[model samples]
Target: MTVADGTARLCAPAPGGGDLGLWQRVIDALRTADQWGSSDSTGTPEIWAHITEGQR
Candidate 1:
């Protein structure tokens, strides 16, 4: 996924690592954005929790 301010990044599926790294980076960036930054790290945890816990 691409972020604003004309600064976009990439994440590739590394061999043997599955799809965790890219997902983490995207979530981390989301946690960094001033416009959408989370008050706590709980945001990523919550979202991932939903996906992981089958709540979504």
Candidate 2:
């Protein structure tokens, strides 16, 4: 996924019957880390929230 110009774009390969739950967990982990930032000292939840808004 990429966010630019106030819009977010996502591109991925067609599902090959993989484990969607695992993919969701990976995405969730990434989002959580982005919210917390490095060492939990520079979180940007607001920006992340805006970028990820409406995204699953």
Candidate 3:
């Protein structure tokens, strides 16, 4: 999945939504947090990399 500008773009699943979906969900959350930015900085949602289970 790809998260950009606070919007989430999910990839088509192979069959049943598997680990990729789960990983995507986690990544989306992190991306959201990152988009929120640090309290000291202005909040501007930016494009972030896809997060996988291993990276967690």
What lDDT score belongs to each candidate, Candidate 1 first?
0.39, 0.44, 0.43
Candidate 2, residue 21: CA error in Å?
0.3
RMSD of each: 13.7, 12.4, 12.5
TM-score against native, each model: 0.29, 0.29, 0.28
In order of lDDT, best first, we have 2, 3, 1
Model 2, range 1-56, lDDT digits (tens) per residue?
67886555443333234789965664675574313222223442222223444544
What's each prediction's clash count? 0, 0, 0
Q: Superposing every Cα of model 2 onto the true structure, what RMSD results?
A: 12.4
lDDT of 1 by residue, 7-49 (tens): 4433332223457887687667556533332223543222211
Pairs in steric clash, model 2:
none
Supply the global lDDT for candidate 1: 0.39
